[model samples]
Target: MAAKTYSAQHFVECDQCEENPAQYFCKNCPGQLCKECKTEHKNRKITKNHEITELNTKNEAFFGPLFCTDHKTKQIQCFCVHCKIPLCTECIIESHNGHAIQKLTKAYKEIQDDLQKKKEKIEEDLLPKYAMLLKTENLKQSDFSKQAQEIEKEIKAHTRQLVRIVKQVGKNATEDFQAKLHKGLQRIVDSEVEIQRKIEKLKQTKDLLSAKIETKPTVSSFEPVNERLLDEFEKLPVLPKYHFSKFQPGKIESMIEKNFGKLPILKIDTAKPNEGDSDIDSQEEEVEEEESDSEVPYNLRLVQESRRF
Candidate 1:
């Protein structure tokens, strides 16, 4: 082989001489070796049995056995099937005797494949659902503001016909309407925040899995993949339902205050069906007077509780 040049800033030094760039790695010693040192390393009686390999980080790390955490001097040789943990020679004899065991390399490859599947699931399934939910929440926010403005217009138009005393009542009603509007919008806001948080969490998990899968598989990664990742993502966030009260203009009867109608009472009908009808449903609020014969309460149903593409 021809001589290879070395960069002063970025090169691993030979473990034996510490003066020349290394060209090989010994898995037995787990150390770097130069061309001259590699020749001498293979000649010695005791050290001659050491296994030397080309100085490639990925190949060396993957092929070499990992040291046991419990028994520092012993290399991990197998995986305990029942415990779902890597085991060294000492571990097999002392702690995991007679336990089912499998080759470490095989277990490492299986884990790598499992992690790849998890990363793909996040990318292909969970992310799109959250993106759609985010879009729907934004549209609902805009629609709520528009509907509230329309109801305010109805109140203002009716307020013009009442006297000073009735106008005061109208003012109070408008203030109350504003307060309710704030509360409804806040519900939508809270849902949006929750969906956004879930989306970010899924993205981070996807990135982590991708990174771990791309890099060389380690002993930690060889352990069983957490089942919760798939279980938790199977459930998407549930959008909240909102109740909006429509403004009803009271009747201005004779000049006597007693004859003038009282402010409209807002009632919500929980029995109304709002789901399983469509992908996106927009229902308007029904406004009615408290004394009126009609018992139908106001219904402000918007968007399905859950949706599918």
Candidate 2:
């Protein structure tokens, strides 16, 4: 049997190829290549100048499922700069045609760059405005609380004043009623004493005659008089029922409204966009779908605004 000699090339791995066709990940390649295949692949004019490194996608996070502007059925694998419409490579010749289109990864990075700048602007300007709004809300709440306290105190004082008036009127009526009651009692006592004295004298005179004598009541003793005096002293009125219905806090009412008016609404003002704001608007940017490559794409998505009432 003859001994076979093995070549060094057999042991060495292939160095150049495409990383993934699904991702359109031509990491500088025309077909699928592992980390070893990167060196031996045919270096094209465009890809020779392009950068390739170890799969360090840990930093490069992504979001997708983008749509093709022209085909509508084709998913957006790439973005055309001049046309500003995303398209798949199959539509690149038919839809994008001759226009320059870059991979969606590059486009995403461009968006990220704008996003980073916008984040800084939000920290410096936009976030502070939110903080200011919170502070304004707090101040308004404090003012409202103060107004509520004042109103409460004023109402208490008003109640006390009305009560005092009722008490004063009741005291005067009670004093008059007491004076009339005392006079009525004294008149009744004097009449009882006069009747006793008269009866004693009649009995003494009748005993001396020793004859049968019929006693007759005198008309003067039961004379009708002063019925109005007894009616006046009856003192039967619901004294506290009458009260001041209209409470006046007229001065304090204005202050209460003033406190409530501290809260203001959002006004219409032209805010200048930061350097990357146009890019944020672009993310919301719409691409028109057409029948073929001949038509122009028109954007129609309007940015929504948030309003505070």
lDDT, candidates in the order shown: 0.67, 0.35
Pairs of residues at least 3 apart in sequence or in different chains that clash in candidate 2: 15-36, 15-37, 15-38, 15-39, 16-37, 16-38, 18-31, 18-33
Which candidate achieves the best TM-score against the true structure? 1
**Stretches > 4 Å off in candidate 1:** 1-61, 243-245, 254-309
Task: Report the CA-based lDDT of candidate 2 relative to the real structure.
Answer: 0.35
Among these predictions, the greatest lDDT belongs to 1
Model 1, position 77, has a per-residue lDDT of 84
lDDT of 2 by residue, 99-121 (tens): 88776656545544444444444
**How well does each candidate superpose onto the true structure, as a TM-score?**
0.66, 0.30
Q: Each candidate: RMSD to true structure?
A: 11.0, 49.3
